[model samples]
Target: MHLKLLYCTVLSLIYGLALGSPAISDSSALADLLESSDKFNDHSVVQAFVEELKAISHSSRNISKCDQCVARLAVGKSLALLRPDLVPPVFTQWCTETQYMSNSTCLSTFSRNTVKSSYTGTNFADMLTLMDPFGYDGQLYCCYKESACSKPKTPDVSLSHKWPAKQTKHKVAPVPSANDTFNVLHLSDFHIELDYTIGAEANCSASMCCTPHSKNTFANLTSHSHKDWNSYYDSHYEGNSLVKGSLIDVFKNDSIWSPATTFGHYECDAPEILINSSLDSIANFSSTNNIDFEFAIFTGDAVDHDELSLTSYEVTVNSEEAVFRDIKNKLGDVPVYSVLGNHDTFPYGELGQENHGFSNYFAWNAELMADLWEDYGWLGSDESQYARKHYTGFSVETSMGLKVISLNSNVWYKKNHYAYWNASQPDTFGQLDFLIDELVESESKDQRVWIIAHIPFSADALPLPAKLFAEVIERFSPYTIANIFFGHTHLDQFEILYSGPGGDAKTIENVVASSWISQAVTPWVENNPSWRYYSVDKKTFSIMNAYNYYTKLNETFTNNGSAPVWEFEYSSREGYNVTWPESAPLNATYWHKVASMVNESVEYNQVYENYAKRFSPYVPDCASTDDCALDYCYLTSFTVDQYDSCVENVKNNK
Candidate 1:
């Protein structure tokens, strides 16, 4: 019989660690040893394989780890090899696995150097299986703060997370009519990787912006990050680098890029330190700023992008739960509505809908949001009752009677693989109809409504037909709709839909269906990681002004002995200077001016640069003038017809 049959575990563990998965090979010495046994094939084949292994063995120490392991496979080991006492399976597995595994530590007698060390002995798979993807779970691997990278951190005492000090007074200026104002925190896309230091290069270009999806090409690390340190310097700081917070800046402040990542499969997500720090940072900011958030809307894509490991249902459930649970811990009593991003669902962009009696997996996923989010004041808790087909669009009315509708816009995502299925569903699975009903209810009661969804409305691949969606929006824009908030584009953008029905009808007399697409908090692409807090009119429910904030990736806590700057970056009404008639801020008239400037060849640059604010200066990389103009037009357009019109305007301008 072949030796491999006798020693499968030893060989499998070594192969999995040294090479990459524990998959069997056809050309390996083990394969030859297994196939060329006297009972299986030519005995000469076994002899040749042993000679080849011996050739490699003599170049190393006498029956070293590799030799001993290989020797066991080729020549066969004594029956003692099977004894767990002589060589425990855990030790054997860990030594090889930890050495080769990307995120691991060698079990130090007194030191905790496993997370970053290339040494072996730790069981990373065991650690990973215990991880809570969102926040601190004892199961995740973390180092002690006092002796970081040297000692492992014991689990935090699981208890009720301490909440922020209660809000006593309002700070910002309220609207003209109302005596009060509501603060809404819009946070999106935090691609938190647990261990990024494993393979992080000195000048990986994705440092400031996004991590390229091609980082998983296996052979070579093909990242969108800057090629060298000099290019990175030139791109971020020019020559005048902000010499503070250096260590904690970039994609991962406290850690390095994970070497163990593959699609859907990951060795880790945000470590407890980093994840808790982020939440603490936000809490501290809000406290120091005297900000009292009435509510918050976290536009989806909570899970990190470019998952190398294939996600399973169990994984999806764990990750999704961890995210919401951690948010609850951090925010405390602050009610925040959430929607599933394309990445939030299993299988990346495929949003599966229910068929016949078959439960749609996406619906199941959305139901998880419903079940977990009920404590956060999600009114659509009764899953079977509130859903419009698989689309989860339900309204939660506040004590003051302000209605907020969370729309499952993934049905309209252009990148969604199941768009065809969404389009074919009856009445768009009552998505649009349900929205109209909500709007109608709000209109009758004069209760203004706000929409929070993942994907924004576009003509192509949307939940409802663009025209129908526009008609419903236009019908309601006059009576009750307040603002529509969305993400997924990963950049700061606005959609200005006509408040009235048709062409050039009344530019000044129009109502702006104000929508804001918040920038992603994840420093994945070149987009500056950010979130926005909008000052909303409590009575009118109109957005008065917007304060956008961003984190500087290059600035770390270690830099210049100061904390990284997470300052208020800009304000919409203040920076744009589109004031008309004194009080109507960012209205249709203002949007029209912006759109005109966008189409205006001479004025487009300033306006475009104004909005496309990155951590550093942004240099446009458009191939030609037409390409630039088309993008400008696309951004200017708010509705489906406007998108088409925006395209026409660009072509005609050409």
Candidate 2:
């Protein structure tokens, strides 16, 4: 799961980008310094890594087996992260010019390599170590995003596997709303591992950085100020003073390592206590918030990161059952629409149409809903119409004439291992095509639409082409698609989508759709585990007010003596200071007010930047505002290209 988290978004700077390696005035000079005198050279290092990449590429020229597909992507991405600057010119040119590259799968479109067929299932230690960006950490290679490497990944397989119905959703009075007003409880990323411990100080840290000390995608984030740099270390790093050791040494000495040894990635994955507390609180909030939420949308990844140990199909079924049953019991009869996350499977993160590589990669959780949710009537008894894409999608019509379509966007996941592809050959399923049809049908009947998924169509989830995703979202136009809700990145952020190309070509007013990149309940990384309450336009369905709720970690774990304090954080309409439209608590008219600040007001932009993380978010304020403006603009219409470009342009300017 830590490895998967590697590709997750950066809410402050740019979200969902495989940020290119930092530029260098003289890469050669730095190479020389690193090789001989500086603090970078090493013994186990492969200086001719680029040559090795070529050899690997040449070897896989005629790869016949499907399992190698995993090895190809795994190894290729490892090489890229190991030395992105060392990316061969020929390879980069081919990737950028000849083929269509997904946000994070540049390695796949370009690399033609195959590892031995031994790295499957639970026996992946050596293979992962081979993929390790050699000589990482102070020798502490905690993780390398989506970390498929050597580390103390929690393999907690011994926990109560049954979901309890100790409490059930109580029937309550619905708060009155305008005839057209639509309210939704937006939830994402429960990451509920049956075995994850609560309040455990994880001294072992994990991150997406190329190096243990560096937190950015690139090892050298020279553009960031020292203060911003420190912030990176503060939020991402997990350890004591730098020490020379293997990734395993930390755990070897772990029984009493440090104050907060991050067991794997960040200190997260919900313990049952937390999950129960969270659900109960959210259920309570909907009843008392004085807002009428029509239904709830959980945008995937309800399962957690214990994939290696989750090798059995029974366990996978159990995990899904636990989460689903819990949500049902807590929400009572509220029809909750859920999506499939990458982690919601057996071998973890597999979403191919056929068996590309994994053994038990059948993603039929949604289909199972026919039985699990029949009483709720969302999926009803017949699953054929709803379970087209591995039971990962379905269109539920609300009484308000709004169509909420949950997509199994996992087919686009970076590590879906080419399930849609033909045995390491290029291929694609008609998932998106299916979505277009759904939307078109909705439009024909004059129905407002909302999309919910675990991953956005961005590199963060290793999604399909950015422009293609933009085209999909933009295809709906002015207001057919009211809003999108997603939750893989676990950051309190917003994505703004412009109907046209995402650049200076579009003016601030030329907007099409906006999304709430909802927060996670796991609190695995930066911010406190949180959820959202959205008040949407009765007519257009755009969010009028978004109230964020968080369990302050420090307070919950320690503050007034470890009694988890679940409290309301702030409202989007209130915190960002968007102008209050007299018609609603917040409205598109006022959303435009917030968007205008991104274009014209620095003060407002700063306020927006500070709250991006919801708890302790930061901006490279001391360094530059170009990226900041771009980040603010992203909330307008989130596009991967614009995000990468904004980051690159900002660094180039620096």
Candidate 3:
């Protein structure tokens, strides 16, 4: 009896399936209603068919054709409800299919409707109909439309059917040799001022005012009073003064005025011009030497502290932009990178309050930000907002094998007014993490990386733990980073050497460029205002320090009217294919060469000559002269006269 009941249920489900029309009142009578409704081709029959299908779908869970019947009925009912104007040809066929008494006839009518409706130019619809028989399958439909159903045409004989399979061999281009040298004109501590007049007012100190030796020198001295004293002193008096005199009186001495005065001021906008001229010289030199630069990286203190106001920030940005624009114009399309210095942030005002207006200036300038982003893709939009004054981890692929990572060290230090000292900040920790991650990833890729930052990891900046620097080097040892470049300490010549945690100590050479704005007035008599140029050899993956390669000041304005000169000095590696000398301690010998070169250059020659005459009268006439015979005689007579005069003066005084 159970088997008989099961068979009856199956028969009832199959026979009870309704046609395309409105739902019936009783599901058990749906099949009968559909059959009866097919006799009429009027709107009422279509509605009745839809109703019968709906009733079967709702009541008969076991009905196999319930969904199909409902869909067909819904379409028929929709057609019946449509206005005459809205009725399409497909709707007419749907009505006929629902009204027909024969099931096979109704199915044939539906197929005909589909064929007539499938009006695509390509045979895609027909192919889809052959492949899917149900509804559209996305992948099959796409294949049919895009590829399978297209009419066959004569294929190109040269084009292979297994195009990707027949791999076209690509030649691996040669990695740039480390020995392939390029000249990098390294400049730092520019302290460029905008609105020099404003500085002239602020810095102009009546009690501090002293007599300037020359008109130009006096003007610069006066400008110093209005400008930030520290910047003025550092650039002009402290850095550039060649004469051995009191720091206060250095400005008063007319004889020292020529080289002692900082020529780049905001009032006349001389800094922009000087920067441009230096760049021009660098480009010309590079062109002559057949050297191509990887990039030009400015090592912080790019701008002078003019004021902390919004207007001052705007002026500073404009001045900085002008300098960059000139550099870009001269250098063509070479990549240029910059790191923040203490002054780049803001001037410390009365109390501990820092005027944060400069940070906003950096944020709004799209060109400045874009330049940094293009070099270092790691700068996210979010980070750009909070610490706009600092930028870290700018990575660029200079060649197939060479990568550069530029970091901003300013974020690692504390800004106390115009003074910057190494102080730990949360941002510094974040930066360290980011740097480590980048180095590890670069090592994994087996690419050569170079790290560039403004401040060196030296003990003088003691608040910055040395252990951190050591960890950084240790983490990236596997990557075979070529070299790191930095600038900040205004050492005429100094080097900070380091040893990685495990490996032999690598002498990461630090180049301290002489201030372009002003040479320190004390110590060295020679006015050596210069910058370092580096040459990278792509083939060897080595960097050569080409120091003092560009003229900072015009010949006519500096020394005794001689053309501005560059000092070139280099140190050969102790052994080939090694990053550093095995046994040699990281020493200042390399930096000494740079300083010596600047001292020997034409710019320093005049200052040296003047110094020798004033301090060492006994020194022979070593000055370049036409007649060698006359030069020696002049030196001997001058020496003899000085000795006799000294002895007689001593006797008379006694």
Candidate 4:
């Protein structure tokens, strides 16, 4: 077991003090005080400080939320100014020791450079300007990250007030004929780890493994007993630095607990070899099947989940460039539309909205993506410019009159601490508003729209944006909006947004729009690498069929450097073994029926679970569990409120 340090709790106490009380603003005085005397280390001084913090934490001071956040920012900025090197290490230590976040996650999230250069802004003070005192980020940092304060109440941004009123009678598109269909490839979450080493550790103590030096390979640390190791780490350093060896060190690859192979591992992202092979397979599948794909939509995440300590802006940019180039090279003449994933950013999941005044800091990513997409001929100059201005989110109408709207959904992601500020606002970046504008235009033109993004508008996102998105779907779906696509979950799943009162799958008429979430090319954690392509009705722009293809990861272990073979895993229309009209596209109504089958049929439930993870061995047995029941609810519920209501209703009925 890795040594779990308790000193992080003390740091949390300090953080609580900063949040609750007016923090010391005189940086020069504070720096001099810390440098001249070790007040933070002195027992008498530290105990007094902790007591003061406790009093502040307990006190009901009539301070505004903005003032509180400003004070907290002051403390953090002062500390960073005093010892820039120490600040990041302390934060990383708190994340790892206090939150039990994996070392890679901690490092990636709070690295020294990432701390000073990215996130809300180029510096902490700029971040303070955007924060609301009652912001969700502070609550997350203080209540969850520090465990020093109670979780704050989430501001209610209900859809009842925001949802647009239906104008005319809801007009549903006619069931399409298969004879007028075309193919569109949908690839997502290709977390291509460029530095993947075949024989590296597949099983490690960290959240992500299967890379060179994936674990702390120090013999002194690894060989010691758990008790002795904890004692050693505790006594030697005060959550400051390792005593002898660095966190990463060269080790015998063969000595790993589980050796990685040519394809990939369940615990790791895709290697370059695996990524190339998958792309090759797609080309071959297209050729052999006599299928001509009109275009491809890549829903982001080109970078790997490497340690933030091991990553740099240059590394992130280079990895993405390489991956995009590879895609262009392998899939010749295929115009691939793309979006930026949460992991695609340097610090990971830290993109800020334009109104937040931090977009310029994160604009390099959008700019680069725009350039790449334009260079590949997937986007025109004006479209690329629009994408660059909007953080790589843009709407482009296809030559065939189908409007494709790609969104930088990370603005609403929970992990982008940037989003936590002014949490009550739904369209902070005006991206959702942009979406509505595009949808309205598409509706007027009688052109169907498809929304593509990296993250789903699900519970993993901040509730307000999700609700707003759900409202958008409710108003425009089944008429203007054909479908939405996402890929961050890395699971083969779907989300149905319904309109009207009771948000449930009790009737098909309520089903408005459905998001088709494709499985990932990166296995990451306990999943077979997979991809999907949709057979669409040219006229309706609705999906006629959905095909999933996957490669067995474990088989590559014995192939001895031979490439893994990609094969068809399932089809939405035929694979479920559920009967539906042949003329109908696999729309929201069809999915609603499948959701019912998942609830009532045992075999179908098991099969659904299996296909979700591409038959990974670690697929959970949700067939007889509340998990299976939740799947029904998850498919039916769109926004946070609906999900909560559905879950409560299910439990109450039971």
Winner by TM-score: 4
Question: Which stretches of candidate 2 lie above 4 Å from their native place?
Answer: 1-182, 198-201, 205-266, 288-292, 306-315, 354-360, 363-366, 383-385, 388-391, 419-427, 461-464, 559-562, 584-606, 616-630, 633-637
Better of 1 and 2 by TM-score: 2
Clashes of each: 37, 21, 52, 3
By lDDT, the best candidate is: 4
Clashing pairs in 4: 65-133, 66-133, 108-308
lDDT tens readout by residue for model 2, 1-654 = 234223211110120011122212123433343344325543222333333223332342454222222333333343343343333333444344434354234443233222224322221221232332223210112222234343222121211121121112111111224645566787788776564421222433332211122122333333322111100111111121122222122222223222221221234466544566677777666668665567888887866655242234555677778887778777777778788787776445655453223322353554565556565655654443556334456677777777887777666564544432221111244566566777767665656788887776544533124455566665564445667778787777766666454543445456555667788887676567678877776666666677888766544322222234568788886786654654553423355567667657677666665555555433336235555645543554355556655566656865
* Cα lDDT computed for each candidate against the true fold: 0.49, 0.50, 0.37, 0.69
TM-score of each: 0.60, 0.62, 0.44, 0.80
Ranking of all candidate structures by their lDDT, best first: 4, 2, 1, 3
lDDT of 4 by residue, 1-654 (tens): 111112222333454454443322222333344454455553432333223323332345665434443333434433443343444554454446545456765565555344334342233334334554334655644543335455455565554443346556446664565568889999988888877765567667655687765763443444322111100111111122213212222134325556565567888988766677788888888888899889999998899887666677887898899889878877888988999988888666777667645676778888899999999999999999999999898988887778899998788776676675666666667887788778777777778889899887665676667777877787786878888898888889988877776455457777787888889999887899998899899888899899999998877654434457789898999988768878888888888888878878877788888999999888778755656667777777776667777888889998
Model 1 over residues 394-430: C-alpha lDDT tens digits? 6777655668887777556544433432232234345
Candidate with more favorable, higher lDDT: 2 or 3: 2
Query: Candidate 2: lDDT of 222?
Result: 34
Candidate 1: where are CA atoms >4 Å away? 1-179, 194-198, 201-278, 307-309, 358-360, 376-390, 421-426, 499-512, 557-563, 601-604, 615-627
| 47 Cα displacement, candidate 3 (Å) | 91
Worst 10 residues of 1 by lDDT: 229-238
Q: Alpha-carbon error at 636 in model 2, in Å?
A: 4.9
Q: Between candidates 1 and 3, which one is better according to TM-score?
A: 1
lDDT of 3: 0.37
